[model samples]
Target: MGVFVASTRPKVVVTRNLGPETMPLLLERDDVEVVVWPEDTYCDRKWLLENVRGATGLLVMLSDRVDAELLEAAGPSLKVLSTMSVGYEHVPLPELAKRNIRLGYTPDVLTDAVADIAIMLALMASRNAEEVTAVVRNGEWPKRPWSPFMFCGPQLSASTVHPQRTAGFIGFGRIAQATLKRLVPFGLTTCLYAGNPATPADPAADAAHARAFGLPRVARVGLAELAAESDVVFVLAPGGPATRHVVDAAFLRRMKSTAVLVNAARGTLVDTDALVRALRERWIWGAGLDVLEGEPVIHADHPLVKEPRCTLLPHIGSASIETRQGMAKMAAENLLGGVLGHAMPAEFTGTK
Candidate 1:
């Protein structure tokens, strides 16, 4: 009898369709068997758990959970999991480390996109743009009579009257740097960022930023100073237990009453109840958020939603078409690299 050989194709499961821009990379490969979730929305957990069995690699969204149960179901054959989003909180790092699975995430590709949102949120929050727009949407724009100083709020730019502005960042990362660069045109005088205190201070790097951005001062400060002095505070920090609720009532209470808060980062970084209280008590002027603690399902009656001074989005920080396509392409490349035993293009080794 003739000898029979089995196919050595690696099995890859995709949580959501990557569309034509990225799917062709995997579909054209004869060495890979690709199984996609086949839907527009989030992939159902039941379907994911069932199909993820024997997967050699998985390209997942932030909605999918890559925990011990998923890892066990994927068996020893699962060597890689690449997330389309920059955040990886959905995937447990310990579990991946235990199984020697490489983690890949899209990072720099979305930096500009997120920074744009951060600035937009700052402007919107300061101007109360959300509530103003709602008047038009609710068919009350014609009925509501305008008065002098009716919609007046803090201005983001520095004029002759307000010659200097200080911008603050919760985390000094690529996105935060991009945001600082964008603020240069607004006549920002000083830049302050808060990072892990355990990490050594880099005066040289801060000096470089000041020189590069033409700012008078670029310094690192503690959160208390950042909250107190900033005209606008951008929350661009990473999410995890270490950073959870970093912006509690104490932090919010310290902020300038006219200063605006913009959070384009993880929702858990800010304490929701504290924020609501701050807005209600007028401790801060307003807030613009692209993410919320219990997100993707915030009801209309949700306190933040009902708060006229608050402008919120459904975590669309990286929703730009160019950014999404780039992320999809990178995620596909990472999956292929891990499956083929090659070095991933953007493998996350975690902070040292």
Candidate 2:
């Protein structure tokens, strides 16, 4: 009888522990060797580089920079990169395409979770919850002077007396549309969106969306018009050079003083310094943000943190238990599929 030989199993390096629910899907696979970063926080940069050497597949978070240097560290053995995020800003797509590597990301699963948080942030910003909570937490509520209008801000919906509410979106993608759906019950009368000008206009589609959402009108408009007309403006645009600082001093200055600004999208879409000045000068009613520029490094003295009108969250738009688990499972599936030479569920087609 001829002796049988076992083929070498492909190796995969996951950047972080994927939690109890999803880690086993990778660990129990006998056809692959799985290596995971033991730390809960972003895997140490040096450690990631060392472990990625000779890795056939890589699983990363949005915090990981999958650029030329890291790609070089992974060597030619790397065939696939999977990220547990909807956004791919941290991944260098052109470099990945140059190397003929497939990319995968979590997308649709996060839409609802993020949309919910967008609405929550809008409410928080408009109600001045950040300032109110600070007062209560600092034990100043008892000594503070109470007035009828104290802690009051603009209402999200139009009252019976003033029944016209307009919601503006910087990007009318899935999450933005989901948020608009949620806002329909709040009596939103009109919807305005500013799409990427590079893409062709689809007025018919916009009209369809408006009809489906029960809004009297839904149309694409210029950024300046959107900033000026919205009762509450939601920034859901992608992050990149073209979109960076799209919402700056000039844009903020155009917004209604009673309008609220909510950013549940990329931090770079809004200029941090400009936003600080906007809040300080009361250019707009208040601002709520789930992501911020140079986040995870925000100091106690950060101007936005100090600003009473800015309600900040530590990027928890997709923090729901169900949503995170789905993201992790899909990311693992994508990594395994790519390593096994199978089709990825959510392959990044931008490079293709």
Candidate 3:
């Protein structure tokens, strides 16, 4: 790799005002000049393109697109780029490689936060909180009489009726492991996960993982088995072409009718149409989601939004105050390190 530097102080174009916790890392430094988007929302493309001309470093959120055009706008002076997100789907990584620009991203800091949301979604969907709460909020609760099964839904905790509880993860990465750790107190007995087919199963590792979690069984199984056996399937995988629509009609059909689906991962992982049909047909108990295929544009009339059995959150898996501050600090550090030609705290290596 080559280290490129400018003759004058490095100029960094930040797509958002990363807040007080992170502004000092760049503003206080005389070595770098910071240009940040003044808006409370995502930076405008025209404004970004115009300002990025002479920048040596750039800090962007997930909404910003980093492609060949953006690189052309940035010129050869651009030596480094950082995104304040774990997923880099918005960025065309090869474009950065072609320009010899180092890339940095914050990943592990939001693991626990995202895992917390996953469990919260699971609980919300399992308990029918969204629908029942809506009835109360709409003034329909007072009109209705209490019954034996008025709002009864599936129970998440292991109980007398269900002695054994199995937890399934679509992709068992850091977030998935954290989710499993949280599920331990819920009296989970088994943990099943699906992995990349290219990587063969390691029974020894699986056994040790199960032992660490105090679970009797932990196996790497096929998607079919994972869907059919799991009581609550948590999708915590990465998003891309290869993994898109992993939860299609076939996968949904294979799931237990009593099971609930929770997706904190990318929306592309699940087919929205298929999920809508699944919920309508009662293929599964309910669903909880933090992301959608075409988000921020999802209207009130969107099919998923209308489904009472589905609980939707506006992609707030990592929206906690503490987690956001940590991510902001990390993103600032990454930008400073790259601009100074030093080691970034969380530099991205294009490897699995």
Candidate 4:
């Protein structure tokens, strides 16, 4: 090599501090110029705009809104936009499409972690884990003797001769497979899934996934069938125009009287008002929600809040240490790939 040119390095801007593990990967590259935010929190809009002015790549998080303003600020040099979240609702796709910018997102990497949270939500909701723990902490449990059926909740793994258990999915995907696998031991033998049409590989791949999980059958059914047949229904779908309020009053009415609902996905997929009415009217046995519609500011008078059977969480689906680290690393890789003129390892193709 006669003379190595340092001018070939492309500029990359990270919107947040990716975990320590990912720092080495970006630093090791000579063809990439990486600029990381010193703070552990989200980067300020002004700072981001200033830093991203001449950058070729941007690695952002769900918290950061990559709207037209941010994209316009990045100018002609920008080649790629990557987010660490599976949900790209925050990004403005139309603007990116106009500029021919490639997008990257971490999807399958955090699937198992999210599914684990979904299962935990179901278990906690069904067993009244929150209230029970509160009672003990407040010294109420010690004051009173345990009575029959007092604080008792519906059994998840009930033994039966026929084993007629059924689970439903609002949006079935990789995380759904992991959740189904965990529920198999609880005598769950059937599943009903309802959502948008399968992708090119979805039909065959879904069947294989179902079989591998030991589920007796996994059928793509309508919303009504999912509501009526399932003992527990998990909402794992994406949030957007087509799926907004997919689960409404009409769908809730069809659910089995003893059924439970769990949602670890987007809040927009469910009608909070309709869900409140359903819970108030006892249409379903209970509900477990990690994500809420109009979150961080839920109405105090919300019906789900008053309903004893409802369990609410503040959306910590992918909160695990390992999963979050992986997400950060993948996001960094996406930015680095764009900066280095290579294909992203987990690029968001905007298929859906």
Segments of candidate 4 deviating more than 4 angstroms: 1-8, 197-210, 298-306
- Candidate 4 lDDT at 31 equals 75
List clashing residue pairs in candidate 1: none
lDDT of 4 at 223: 87
lDDT of model 1 at position 290: 98
> Order of candidates by TM-score, top first?
3, 1, 2, 4
What are the lDDT figures for the candidates, one per model? Answer: 0.93, 0.93, 0.93, 0.83
Winner on TM-score (1 vs 3): 3
TM-scores of the candidates in the order shown: 0.96, 0.95, 0.97, 0.90
Taking the tens digit of each residue's C-alpha lDDT, what string does model 3 give over 115-193?
9999999999899988999999999988989999999998888999998999889999999999999999999999999
Scanning candidate 1 in windows of ten residues, the lowest lDDT window is: 2-11
Better by TM-score, candidate 4 or 1: 1
Off by over 4 Å in 3: 1-7
Q: Could you give the candidate ranking by lDDT, starting with the highest?
A: 3, 2, 1, 4
lDDT of 1 by residue, 1-352 (tens): 9989865788999999898988999999999999999999989989989988899999999988778998899999999999998889899999999999999998899999999999999999999998888888899888978898877898899989888899999999899999999998988999999988778999999999899999899999999999999999999999989999999999999999999999999999999999999999999999999999988879998999989999998998899999999999999999999999999889999773
Number of the top TM-score candidate: 3
lDDT assessment of candidate 2? 0.93
Q: Give model 2's TM-score versus the native structure.
A: 0.95
Q: In model 2, which residue pairs have backbone atoms overlapping below 3 Å? A: none
